[model samples]
Target: MARATTAHQLHDLGLAAWFGGTLANAVALNKAAAHSGDAASTGAVANEGWDRWTPVNAAAIGAHLIGSVGLLKHDLGRMSVQKGVGSMALAKTAVTIGALGVTAYSRVLGRKVSQHHAVPAADGTTPTASTPPDVAAAQKKLKQLQWAVPALTGAIVAIASYASEQYRPEEVHRGMLQRVLP
Candidate 1:
């Protein structure tokens, strides 16, 4: 029979999954918007993406709440061995770093693209200083994405590390399986 899981274990697992899924969705949407250069789409995506965090963060907080209540209850259950938590954490770190780098690249691209484009001011005169509203809006979202993606990626690492430690203590325990299997 499996040992009982500490409340902390469940919380980490839930948060890791939530953060990972959220980051993936945001990154995918941002990529699509970047490709299409659609301001409405980008802005809408940004709005939805950013808004998702309100509830998600709340859920994570709720996990903490549940964890705190663990004192009132007996053991819930032992966390299963999550095979890929360590790999997932490492992968997440790489992705996050890449996302940050992409942010810089995106900003440079936006500036260059804006230089070739023009936007109409309130007077309807095209401003040489900026791109059109649609283009500008899209760029603005990209700018936000540049920072957001990497930040989210980092969160994935943090979440993964927390989850992995609880589910896979083997690396710390240094199981005899390492000796036998090798």
Candidate 2:
């Protein structure tokens, strides 16, 4: 068994936070916000939670990106000679880019909604009829984006799992053999 490096630890830990935090907020915080009394309070509650999470989320993303670069650098030699490794890395890169885009966009929408601190809402993403047009629109977008961030991040996790499997001794041996033989 190989020892885990700093990059490996950071990559897994950061991704775990990125995926788990968003899922928990979507599953629990958003819905729970609705129970905070009036429409305005609901929006405030949700915004407060999300706002607090933003800094931590940014840190997690930064750590993940740094770790990803480190891992890719370390794997370059193997990627060049191992069948399927380069393509798999490319796929993971694409998915990671997609996840980053969704996360950024969601944060933008969240800022839009949060700017109007006292804005009315039914829940984190649900806009009450009295919600101002701009805030309501932002909320609507956020509703969809909330799910998207987690889905895309979850995809990254899945791909990472597959990539890990490719690192097994037998798999690596077979992959290297196929690369040289064909």
| lDDT (10s digit) by residue, model 2, range 1-182 | 13237777788889999999999999999999999999999999999999999999999998888888887887788898888889989998999999999999899889999999878999999999999999999999988888988898898899889889888999999999999995
Question: Quick one: RMSD of model 2?
Answer: 1.5
lDDT, model 1: 0.45
Error of 2 at 12 (Å): 0.7
Q: Candidate 2 — number of clashing residue pairs?
A: 0
Candidate-wise lDDT, in order: 0.45, 0.90
Q: How much is 85 displaced in model 1, in angstroms?
A: 20
Off by over 4 Å in 2: 1-4
Best prediction by TM-score: 2
TM-score, each model?
0.36, 0.96
TM-score of 1: 0.36
Taking the tens digit of each residue's C-alpha lDDT, what string does model 1 give over 1-182?
11125565654554464456546554564455333344434434434544455466446546634643451143222212233334554564465456545544544544443343322221111111334555555555554554564475466557545544644556534433443354
